[model samples]
Each structure stands twice: as structure tokens, then as C-alpha cells.
Target: MLDATTITAPIFIEDMEVGLTRHLEKIISDHDISLFAEVSEDRNPVHLNDEYAESTMFGGRIAHGMLTAALISAVIGEQLPGHGTVYLRQSMAFLAPVRPGDLVRAEVEVKSIDLRRSRVTLDTRCLVDETRVLHGEALVLAPSRG
Candidate 1:
């Protein structure tokens, strides 16, 4: 029996179409940096130690590139193809550093939809204000209707 405590993310891909887009914004905070560092075990000095990072090319602490890119995943999973979508592949390029407290805006736009194969191709990008910090492409298996 389905109970109140049971979690569910229903498949909603039948109506998926090309050109659809979604956006997600988040402030990447100091606490966020610390927590992501811990969870990802990416204790890189550039991403964790302000003093050490000051000597690096970025000149100070910076968030992990993947941490910024993860926002793309959030947009895809929660809003684009949306809940229950299965990720098949992703490719990204990091363009700039995201320092603490930057408001990262992530957007994903569906570039194509192959309904026969239940596949969706999306263009993804993350920006700090008008500056793009990351850009990528993602291919996902849009859930098939039974």
C-alpha cells in the first residue's frame, strides 16, 4: 500500500518538448562550500583554505567547479525534464571561479527530444550574474510512459 511516508517522483515525460527550459538559483555560501567540500571529500586548498588559495591563480578561496556545475543537475532533475528523469550523460567546461556568496543562476534548455527513444538533449549553463561560470550539455533518458 502507498503510505504517506512513501516518497514518489512521478514520470512526466510524455509531454516533454524541445525548447523547454528551467532555471534554478542558489547562493553559494561559505557554509555551502564547507558542506560540499565535506560531502564530496574534495578538500582542495583552492576550495577550502583562504590563505593557501590566496597564493594560487584565483587569488583566494573558490568553490569547486563541480559544485557549481551541480546546479545544472539540480535544474534538470527538479525542473527541466523534471522529477524521475534519468541522466545518461553530461559534459561541462568550467569558465570562471565562483567565490563564496555568489548567486549562481543555473539554466537548462531542452535542445531536442526523441520521443521514440525517450531521450532528451539539453544545453546547460551556470552563471554568476551575467558572467558564465560553467556551460555544458546533458543527455538524459526521459522516462517512458507505460
Candidate 2:
């Protein structure tokens, strides 16, 4: 049996030297699309209307910006941060369109650590093949005994 507390131990800068990588492949299920539409209430034709999307620059429906942003959360929450890590801040740039069938892989690396403050800087990116769909930096508060 896996102990939740042990699994959630705070990861320090040195601890992250081993590095972490994760790959995600999704077919952009209808449920994910519909949920994004409902929550954001952004009826952007490019994201909601197939006909409108067909005429747009994308030539087809594309996922919302926030939907793509969620990929970052997955990287931190499930991978780097793991269970008990707390998010501090994030900065991101969207570079490419994410279509319904596109497969996005998010990569995160610990760039720097402020041990005194118990904070870490992470380099994050979401990509499809060699093209980056999203790029950003994330700051997280690492748990410490201090």
C-alpha cells in the first residue's frame, strides 16, 4: 500500500535534479469540449461552431486557451508538484492552435530553486511534435520544515 503522506513529500531543488517527464495523448473527447464550452461560456465560433470554424484561419474547430492551459495544471499537479505541492504563479504564451484531434504533450523542468524561500521556478511547455503550442514559467511553493 502506498502512503499518501510519503508520496506527498515536498520535492526540493536538488531532489528535482533527476528531472521528470510525462506524455499525454488525447482524442479531444466531446465531453472535454462541451465542459469547456459550458464553463467558459465562450461561444467563440472557432471553438463551438464547426461551420464557423471551417471558414476561419484554423479551418476547423480549436480548443479554448484555458482548456490548453489545463495541460499545465496536469503537469504540475500530477507530475512535478505531485500531491501536496502548492502553485504560486504562472506565465504562459500560446503559440499555436490546438485542434480537436491534436495530441499535446506537456514537459516541465525545475529551472531554479530559492531554498530560503522554499520556492521553485519551473520551465513548462506544451507541444505537438516539434511545434510548441504553449510555453510558460511556473513558480511553486515547496513545503519545508523551516
Encode model 1's per-residue lDDT on 1-146: one tens digit a residue.
Answer: 12435554633567766777888889999999999989999999898898999999999999999989888987777667766789999999999999999999999988888877888899999999999999999999876665
Cα displacement (Å) at residue 56, model 2: 1.4
lDDT of 1 at 60: 95
Mark the regions of model 1 whose C-alpha exceeds 4 Å error after superposition. 1-11
Output the worst ten-in-a-row residue range by lDDT, candidate 2: 1-10
Off by over 4 Å in 2: 1-14, 18-25
Best by lDDT: 1
| 1-146 per-residue lDDT for model 2 (tens digits) | 12335554445444665244444545565567779999889778788889999999889889887888887776676657555668989999999988887777778787777777777788888887789999998898865555
TM-scores, all models, native as reference: 0.89, 0.83
